[model samples]
Target: MPHAKTTPFAMPLPDALAHVDRVFGIGTILADEGQDIVAPYYVQSEPGYKRVHSEKGCMHMALNTDGVYTADGYFTQIREVADQIRQVQATRVLELGSGMGFNTIALAPDHGQVTFTGLDLMAHHVSTARNDAGHLPNASFRQGSYTEIPEDLRGADVVFGFETLCYAADLDAVADQIAAALAPGGRFVMYDGFRRADFAAAPQDVQTAARLFEVTTAVTNGFHTIEAWDAALRRAGLVVLRSQDLTDASIAGLRYLHNRSARFFRSWKYRLLRHVMPKYLIRNAVAGLVGPYMIEGAGPRSGDTMGAITYSVLVVEKPR
Candidate 1:
């Protein structure tokens, strides 16, 4: 993407304000109760999906089948994740970007004696999750950045992130922190999107779409490819055990979002807001409310069909 043309003077009112608002909105929405995780604005897909999984799509397909959130079967997938943690016999586990602690609450009981420490960047998310998991004595939530896992929190047997690592401006440092936090032979499992190694080789339209997705979603470094992620892990003293591309199955989420956004965009409220709201507020609102859908739309175009992006699950281990 070409650099934006800047004037010799400071940026104008709403433009500068819009930029700040967008950034702040992205950071704060985790705690926004108005957004429902059950029907998250940013709908997520499971690990494996056929062209059409069900009447509603992979999400419903997973839900009806007792599937974990955006993952495969509930029992089987959770068993696998638990088993991976069990491999090291992790009594204490750390989850980065724990969001509302839904995943932690869902998976904690299955592990019996294992304890889960959920960390998120938003304090409200932490408090809300704490309340949500009040019954789960083994699960706890705190606010913190993924870039630096606190010293006291280090030495966890496993560290996992679910679609959260993309927010890191320094993935290498994040990886290093995870490595430092893990016990020898500890595991790190992540489910997120990555740019293809040959993403640059994709068509111009696809390239632009990918860039827009990053900009819209406020991703620090945006999507990464397996090669880049693998290199980062290796540099941080972690070994990549598995990287499974799920781009095809994940397209359903994007398709669902695009359709959903189409209806909302045509609504009178949205129309009024677009034209009547101040430029900064409008930009911030779009970035918070609609930007995710726009970014989701780009997924299939850049990932599933264009081969420029891949949504994948990664399993890595720290050397013993």
Candidate 2:
């Protein structure tokens, strides 16, 4: 079992595939065409996100900067949002897909003068976030999708979504909405998984791993490339300020999840529990197990360093 020392994955790509196949056959990993599974997926996966991912209710990836996994890694996206707030001197912030109000709640207390609004598609998530944010007068949560931001919520100084935009069905429509929602000179930040520009050229196994990761997490249509997002934003009359690949920083946390998910496949007890659990919830293990392989390529043995997907940050701004 050879490993890629450059990556945080412990098992080789072939071994990882075997583990996933043992639990959920690889042939059955993809969703049927035009399936509306995102909302239900989140509903079923909330508990898992709270327990396995973060107790604070973070549903996004933990970004480790020094190649070490730590609880602080969860705050990486938060810090980026906070920096944008200060940079823009923002008084109003809107977070798209603000799951459980993690980002808004964390920033509201420190910026007392700033008002924070978090919009999510899940009513359960909004209810939970509202409960969690009861103490913060400056923060509020609403149940809504980013595809059609409400008219009253427009003119925000900062608009961001952490690991949520990948669920977007139409990039052009969402980009237009974001541009319309932001005030002049306002910033829009998104952190999520994206297909590499050369995704079609990647190995078949790597492509399969990327698609498996997408379907398990309910991104049934698949991740759009960064280039597609950038072009869409520009067409909507926004400036693309940054598009940084943070895949290296995500390795440690992804590997941690991969190892944890591997346990469910290796143990008879955990495997049995899958029958009792919600199908979407139990299938999360498939995403966690294949996540690292999709982003880090098969392994050193394959001599393929070009991965099929990347975790990245894209920043754009509405013109003044």
User: Which candidate ranks first by TM-score, i.e. highest?
Assistant: 2
Give me the candidate number with maximum lDDT.
Answer: 2
Total backbone clashes of model 1?
2
Error of 2 at 204 (Å): 1.0
lDDT of 2 at 101: 82
User: In model 2, which residue pairs have backbone atoms overlapping below 3 Å?
Assistant: none
lDDT, candidate 2, at 71: 76
Model 1, 101-218: lDDT tens digits are: 6667778888769888999876656876788788888998988877878898888888888767766567688888989999888898887767778778765544544544454444
lDDT of 2 by residue, 1-320 (tens): 21223554656777878877877888777743257788878999999999987777988898987877887899999999899999999999999999888888989999999999999989999999999999999999999999999999999999999989988989999999999999999999999999998999999889988988989988888898999999999999999999999998888788888889888877899999878999889999988888888888887667876689999999989989
| Cα lDDT over the full model 1 | 0.57
Please give the distance, in angstroms, between residue 106's alpha carbon in candidate 2 and its true position after superposition: 1.0
Pairs of residues at least 3 apart in sequence or in different chains that clash in candidate 1:
194-224, 195-224
State how far residue 120 of model 1 sits from its true place (Å): 1.2
Q: In model 1, which range of ten residues has the least summed lDDT?
A: 1-10
Measured against the true structure, the TM-scores of the candidates, in listed sequence, are 0.68, 0.96
